[model samples]
Target: MAKADNIFNIRGRLGDFIFCQRNGKTYVKRYSGGFTKAATQNHPNIKVGQERFAQVSRYVKSLKQQLQPYLWRQKDGTFHNQLMALFLQIAKNETEKTFNELIHELDSYSSLSNKSLNKNSKIDPSTLLYDAKTNKLNLGIIPYELAVKYKDMYLEVATGWYGVDGEDILLSKPNIQYIKLDKQTKNEDVIVDITPAEESQTQLPFVALAVVYTDDKGSESPHLVHTVMACFVKMRNI
Candidate 1:
């Protein structure tokens, strides 16, 4: 016959604890902790060391959630522009490269495109493309009024692309309107009531808000899209 010993002891400092188990002739350290003390202490019969394990598990889960958006953005073009700037130093001497080759290289370097980023979102790219193609191209170096108008349309499409419902994703207050008094003088003001939707509980989760504009002609040139994703929220109202 074998004697059975079942005793669990927790030994540690105020902020931490360790669990030890005694089984007949042998003693074993069961768990260590920093995060799981509350959840573990809730169930006493479980091994001393086991409670802390749950805390570590939960921490890892939280970390993964936090990193998900960043990981997705990285696959897009968030860092590509910086890398391209650095690559310019090395490629400066390689002028012998064909134009098509350079284009291919740049495309390969940044595999992410705005379209790919918004593929799962609610906005449709075809509409934006049509607007860009049909709109008269202003040859001026600076963005013209029409260009800004088109940019606004693009932003609306991008907002809708996220597929979030309601007016949760709103253009920042006061749509900016620029008026030119002369060649060098311009005035800017906010436009109101452009969108009638109010901030409400039923509003879709606002993943991001953006302001996009262009400095070049309405070609396939890069346009800025300020994107924001919903993660943190203030607890005042809800």
Candidate 2:
């Protein structure tokens, strides 16, 4: 490509040259054309990429549905797209991995409202307490800042699982419980039961904890809520 400094501030094609703008500067280059659909389809690497993408897409779709309650209020596909990329990394690995290993990978990542919650929520996964036997979560203590900022907020505790177990692929619906928060002078500890029904207990379990703020203005933004993966335990361990 060559800079176009002439008086004619040109763009598009003129004879064998093509003119365009780059970083606020005008430039001209040869019209070598571009790839055709047939060329792209015939490329061996591109075909493999297409197949890999399809497989990863299916995996992401299965997992995204179980988290729809927490994700529906999102304005864009940012979370879905990022999740797809994360799943792709797992799918590309050649080493065989179990379902619990896959859930661990997800647990290592941040939650939906990671930015604001990480700075203010104070709900640490390490400190999170859950009793698999009773299906109860001890929501240690409500953060003073969160309590004061959103006095009408509530907590959402969820549990579910998705992945292969033996010859079957388990994708169970999440069991959620909500606890209303009232005005408080100090931090308070809260516990709630999220026991899955007999039918819902068909798979392993992954627990999630979240805070939802009730907006008086009736806004529908998912940003008003923050969620984190509290814990995951294999069915055998449970």
Clashes of each: 9, 0
| Model 1 ranges off by over 4 Å | 1-187, 198-238
What would the TM-scores of all predictions be?
A: 0.20, 0.51
Backbone clash pairs for candidate 2 read: none
Mark the 10 consecutive residues where model 1 has the least summed lDDT. 155-164
Task: Provide the lDDT at 121 for model 1.
Answer: 28
- Give the per-residue lDDT digits (tens) of candidate 1, residues 1-238: 2222445343333243233334434333424544577766666545423433343334334423433432233233443343333334323444455322333232322322223233322222211111122221111222223334344332211121111123122222322223221232123221111222254322211122222333212212123322312121111122
Worst 10 residues of 2 by lDDT: 112-121
Scored against the true structure, residue 146 in model 2 reaches a CA lDDT of: 45
lDDT of each model, Cα atoms only? 0.28, 0.53
